[model samples]
Target: MKFTEGMWRLREGIRIDWMNNVERLRVENENVELLLNKFQRHRGDTLNSATVTASVTSPLEGIIGVKLVHWAGQVDNGPHYQLASSSGHTKINHEKTETLSYDSGALNLAINTAPNELDFVFSGAKGKLTGHSWRSIGYVGDQTTEKSQWDDGIFFERQGYMLAALDLGVGEKLYGLGERFGPLVKNGQTVDIWNEDGGTSSELAYKNIPFYVSSKGYGVFVNHPGKVSFELQSERTTRVNISVPGEELEYFIIYGETLKEVISRYTALTGRPSLVPSWSYNLWLTTSFTTNYDEQTVTGFLDGFRDRDIPLGVFHFDSFWMKSYQWCDFEFDEELFPDAGGYLKRLRERDLKISVWINPYVGQASPLFQEGKKNGYFIKRTDGSVWQWDLWQAGMAVVDFTNPDACTWFSNHMQRLMDLGVDTFKTDFAERIPYKNIQYHDGSDPARMHNYYTLLFNKVVYEAMISRYGKSNSLLFARSSCPGGQVYPVHWGGDCESTYEAMAESLRGGLSLMLSGYIFWASDIGGFEGTPPPALYKRWVQFGLLSSHSRLHGSSSFRVPWIYGEDCSDVLRDCVKRKILLTPYLLAEALAGYNEGTPVMRPMFLEFPEDLNTYPLDTQYMFGSNLLVAPVFTDEGTVTFYVPHTPEDSQGKWVSWFDHSKTYEPGQWYTETHGFDTLPILIRPGSVTPINPKLKAPQDDALNGLEVLVNGSLANDMAVQVVNPSKTHNVLKVIKIESQSGNVTADDAGVKVVRIGH
Candidate 1:
């Protein structure tokens, strides 16, 4: 992806023809088309070589879109991300002597029209955020005449790359590239938007979205489902370079005065996160992958949670639920689950939702493989044969979701499982899709389909659930995603080791995901690859309980509390109980996500955008607009965190939710010591957090008795919305907790107000 060794010279075999000047501009009704030439001396200078044409349009209010093309022979096949609007209402005008400008709502774009120069600047309400200048746009190619070792014909086609470099300002930072596990700041990183199955330890990401927001108050979204190579201050120190392998590249420049607004607009253009079931916010227990478990082991684990008084919502069955090497047969292993229907009935009778793991793979050992191949349900190679590989399963073929009958075939299998009482599907492992010589059913671009396949894969299962159970009851435990994948509810961090470091990395990934328009995210509680020690297990329990969704899972060992130590049971119980108690509050935040595109687990910068300190801080995050959760990530239980504040905001107070007697002022760093049972959870100032302390199950209709905790002074009246299990908020009965005046009242309801720090 990097084309240069350093600033001075290009890397070997790389040839770039940069866009030097705009030769002529043609104005249209909604857009402007510009023909670009490399040389500006004479008309005949545009002889035997390359030329570029750019189409500028606006897809939404305050969003500028530019599509640059170098060749016309590329096919229009697509697995394109569904844009909410193709184009917005636009206005265009030009000055006679110098420039041509386009305005869409508050965003404005101006292009300098001088003979030998091409400068495009994007400005929001405040001023110019970023722009393209000089030789920033380019058509790149690898001119290696040597034959490819894999195939001689492969090198004959001169596949070109389209690249654009947007100017970056001094001290500007970049964030959000779809659940990255590396640094929170994206500078000095070469990020390629390619989905891979590599675990959380590596640069490969399961969800690689081609969009990023800058600290300079704008966002750039590469409008390609294919791989987008980004050099964020790496190849070029002062610019963020974006490149895609194709004849054309298109990108959208969205402007917002605040970063939160930027995310809102971006989500509006792509898709907003769907509202998941409220019960999904509760604790989930899984049959750990690769662990020896049968009906007895499963019943014992459920009974163990009941015996310990832990409130569990959903129980998941991992890959071993199906017969070995026969995944996607969608049948429970007969030896392990002889009475699959009756066993699921018993679990449902116990008020537990059932989730089973499923991928889009049809293994050759299974009967579904032949059915899929015969019906053209599997992805095919160019030679008209089903593509098979031995990576995860022997002779596995990926299901081609582009085929309608294939989708129907897969959905019917899921519906059969639903008839057996499976509540949700953990849609997993589409990140390893093959790209070489692949042929989709609908002739989609294979490069684009590599990442977009997960979107369609999750969508097929999600829609099946919705068709069966209705939207309110639908949810998915997806492992891979793309830009529009937020339409599905929940995604988990993939394959992390059982360590505190892995836990921290998981949090970083989750926070990064939230910034990328994903509302809900979870991870393996005791980690996925190995068993965590008692200390790490207990700490992870607390952290996971606070997340939007929690699941106890492991790779080789069962994640039951007793496996670590006896005390872990208590830690797990307390956290699960607390999570259940906070369900009303959490579900309200989930509603906020659906309505506003705000992430429930928000990074600190989203909450406190004016404070520069919060930009790179990923250790702590705000759980909704209130509660700040600083997860304890070390063995010693020592913690350090910062509370952001400006001059006018310094007078506010941060009250500790765990220790009522402890309070801290804003705008300073604080350190503390604690046991495994406690971490730093602080309620922000001017907020009213509703708590349902006596709830035993997440689905219980227990909003009748509510305890409101008022933090600091609510300069204005604070109202907390109580929503039911359904999507509707109970607007008739409102709870008002008056601050600066210790008066609290409810609209003829049983609500109690407790003042924490007045």
Candidate 2:
């Protein structure tokens, strides 16, 4: 998607038309209409003239919207949020000097137009916001379907586009591109906001978002469902360049006082995340991909864990639940599962939820393929043929989510599965969608369909559960996503290699994605690509158990704890018990995450935004607002993490939960080595983090034995809540921590604050 020749000149066969002049300005009430062009077109050129009509208006005091329309007949079935805060009435007035400005509540949207330049500056009662300036808007094109060895004429099409990128400040760092597994700081990276299945070790991502936030306290969201390219200090080193193929590009500039507010407002615009079931936060065990297993085999594994006294939550049945080449038939292989519903019921009777793997694929051998083709429920090529691909399955066709009938048909299949006690669907393989020579019922652009397809797929399945089990009980173990995909809860890192390097890479990716505003994260506990040594599995289990969501899955092998030997079960039990004990604290964190779009498993910068070292540190992350979790990525248990100096939490009271004998400081780095049992976990100063020493994840009685640890003499009160994932805060123990008055408690809630220098 890079159109530059060595970052200097435009490539060959490329044509760019930057808006040089605003030829005419017509004002109608609060709306201003302007005609933008490259040059004047004569009568002979009128038919092929490339001109754009931009409509601009101020909907609120600090908000401006520009809707660029090329084809008026297109439907805008908008999935946008209704503005909660609508400001003053807008007024547009034109001056004699050819400058048209809209005035509203001391905020002015001035359109300074002349022969070769245009500028829209927004300054208001509160502050100054971002806008466009000289040569900022452009329409560019490249010979697409004309000549390309990459794809056939049926695939690539001649494409024209609009592009823009705003300037970056001296110390500004960019964040959030939807669960990226790269550097936490997005600078020096060339990202395509296109979802793909490139795994954790590559530049490609499964969840790509066209929106990104900055350390300077603003967010930019590209309003495109297509593959939008971002050059974050990669092309120019001082700007975030955004480009999308089409006639026009529009982006929103969101402003807020803090980074968290920016995310809350942004999610408010796109969609709020579905509140996941409290049990969904517990560790999930699965039958790995391409592994052979049956009821006896699965029961043996479950019994093995039970014998070891390790708690098991939801169990997942991966692919191969169906016969080979019959994927998405929505029927369990009767050979393996003679009584599917009865067996699932038995499993659920043991107090476990059930999840199964499914994708939107219709293989040739599947009975539903012909039915879909006959009913036009599958995506079709230009020649009236079903778009068939042999990548994952032999002659598999994708369900056209743009087709309402197809969505209904797909949902019916899911309902059948849910009727059999399948609590959730592992909605996987959405990244490899077709983007060319395809027709949609809604006539949506195919390029846009590539990323938007996942949104539709997850939505359809999520809604199916809502109809059947209700909204509060719905969830998905999705592997791919887009900007709006955050509306679905839990997404995992796909197909990582079984190595320490890949483990670290997974953490980096999770942290990167967390900064992009995803709340829940999970990964293959013992690795997926190869068999790991006992050390690796044990280490990975500890890290995975600490995540907001955890899963044990693999490829070509079973990821059961005993597969690595009985010692691995001990590791699982240890970590799972601790995670259960930490539930009271984690649940409160999840609730706080709802109001502010912070991830339950967070990047270090989110908790310590001022520390420059924290900006690039991705190896470690915060479990919530309090505990710092540094997962041991190596076979050796060496650990390193940063502590920020906060006015509320000073150095003296920082305590290690594992060893109360050891203490740390603020604004410094700590290195320690331990046995296979522990990783680095620290409590910040003046932190009133709660804990429940039990092996249960969800409970209504949170007032029992609430243990609150006060880190230091904090100047402010740290409110303590021992509640579940429903976001209802219960003050089991509320105390005021101060350097002046000391720790004052309202009740005997087993709260303790070891005074620093005591």
Candidate 3:
């Protein structure tokens, strides 16, 4: 993806034609077009050279999209990212021979048209954000010449690439390239936007989205489905170089007054995260992969949680549910689960939901594989044979979701499971798709479908679930995703090792994904690769239960809490109870995420955009708009976290949720040691959190025993929306609380009020 060796020279076998001057400019309504050619000195300079055609338009109110094309004759196949657009919101101005500007809301794109100088400058309400200047836009050719047997038969094959570089301002930090695990700040990093199955320890990511939010109150989304490479301050040190191997490169510049508003607009263009069911917020226990488990083993795990007085929500059956070597058969192993339907019915009677594991692969041993091969329902090679690989399963063939009949065939199998009382599915492993010498049934470009395969795979299964269950109850614990995949709720960080470092990385990945327009995210509670030590398990349990979704899963060992120690179970029970009490507040945040694209688990900068101290702090995050959660990473239970100062807080203070008497001033850092039962959960000033202490499960009515917990003094009366747990986006009531004489009282006489700090 790197084309230059340094500033002065290009790499071998590379030729780049940078856009130097605009030869002609045309405006049609709100759309602008430009014909850019190389530096023009005279009429002789215009012969036999490459030129780039640029088109600019506004997709949304505050977004401007630019497409640079090197060649307009190449055919563009299918597999494009879905974008929402609106018209009649743009204003265009053309000043004679000097400058041309296009305005979308408060964001403006200005082109400098003075004779040999062509530059594109983007400005917002807060002055210039970023722009293209110097050697910023170019078309590159990578070629190799070969000689044939005859001396005259010499030929060259060249791969064309279009690139655009945008200016990076001083101290501007970038984030959210899709669940990255390296660092929260994306400066000095070369990121390749390709989906892979690599674990949490590598730069390779399972979810690679080509959208990034900047610290400068703006964001850029590269509108490509295929591989888009980004050199973030690594190549030029002051530019974000974006290159794609094709005829054209399209990107959108989104601007807002704040970072949260920028993300809101980005998600509006891509897709908004769907609201997941409330019970999914509770604890989920899974049968660990490769562990010896049958119906009896699953029963014992359930019994263990019940005997220890721990509340459970969903019980998941991992890959072993089906026979070995037959993954997508969708039938229970007769040797292990003789009466699968009866067992699921009994679990349903006990008020538990059932989730089973599945992938978009049909192994050769599965009966459906032969059916699919005969019907041409799988991805095929040029010879019209199914593409097979022996990586995860024997002779595994990827199901072609592009074919309508193939999608129906796959969904019918899922429907059979739904008839047996399965409530949801853990859609896993669509990242390892083949892109070379393969063809989709719908004739989509293979390279483009490589990352887009997960979207189709999850959509098929998610729609199946919605058909069986209503939209309010449909959910998927998906593993891989792309740009518009947020419409299918609930994805998790995949395949982490059982260690404190991996636990911290999982948190970093989840926080990064939330910033990418995903609302609900989880990780393997105690990690997934190896058995976790008791200390690590207890710490991870606390962190996992606080997330939007919680699950306990591992690779070789069972994730049952009592397997570690009695203390682990006690700590997990307390965390689960606390989460159940916090469900009323969490549901409100989920509604915001669904309605406005505001993430439930937010980075600190998203909440306090004006506070410079909050920009670099990824170790902690705002649980919603109010509570700050700093997970204890070390076994010693020592953590240092920061509290930010805001104008909303009169006293500029934060109160600890654990010890209500303990308070800390804002704009300072504090280090504290906690036991296994506690970490730092601080409530921001002037916030009221609704709690239901008597609720046993998240499915229970949250309004039954709701109590408003006021954190600090309220300058004015605040209204809190109490959400109904069973329905989506349904508000049961809004409780109005009046703050008088350092004490708060609710308007509803039946609701109890609890005050934390005065």
Evaluate model 1: give its lDDT: 0.87
Candidate that scores best on TM-score: 3
Of candidate 3, the 10-residue stretch with the lowest lDDT total is: 144-153
- In lDDT terms, which candidate is top? 3
Encode model 2's per-residue lDDT on 1-758: one tens digit a residue: 55666545887867666665577878876777888765444545434546667787554443456655433454544333233345446777777436777765454567777555567665444444545665555666677545443555556434666667566767778887876777778899999888888888888998887778877666777777887899887876666777876666666666566667667767766666556777776778999998999899888888887788888888999999999999989999999999999999999888888999999998999999999999999888978899998888899999988889899999998898888999999999899988778777677767778888888999899998989977667789999987767778778988898888888888877876776667788889888899888889988998899898889999998888787888788889889888877777777777666656777887777777667677777788888987888878767788877776665544455678787667777788988876678888887766666666643655434555456666656666555655544433333434444546456465643554444322
lDDT of 1 at 219: 90
Candidates ranked by TM-score: 3, 1, 2
Worst lDDT 10-window in candidate 2: 76-85
**lDDT tens digits, residue span 1-758, model 1:** 77778767787878888777777889978889988768568877778557889999888887889999999787789988889775547889987447889998888899887776788899888788888887788888776633224354644444478989998889999999999998888999999899998899888999998889988888999989989999999988988889988789999998887888888889999998888877788889999889989999999999998998888899999999999989879999999999999999999999999999999998899989888989999999999999999988899999999999999999999999999999999998999988989899999989888999999999999999999989888999999999999999799999999998889899999988898889899989989997798999998998999999999989899999988888999999999988888877887787778877899898898888888888989889999888999999888999899987733336778889987778887888999887987899998877778888878777777565667787767776766777776553333245676655744764624677777764
Pairs of residues at least 3 apart in sequence or in different chains that clash in candidate 3: none
Off by over 4 Å in 3: 144-155, 739-747
Off by over 4 Å in 2: 6-8, 20-34, 37-117, 120-134, 144-158, 650-653, 724-758
Q: TM-score each candidate.
A: 0.97, 0.89, 0.98
**How does candidate 2 fare on TM-score?**
0.89
lDDT of 3 by residue, 574-637 (tens): 9999999998999998998898899889889899887899988878899998899999999899
Kindly give the number of clashing pairs for every candidate.
Answer: 0, 3, 0
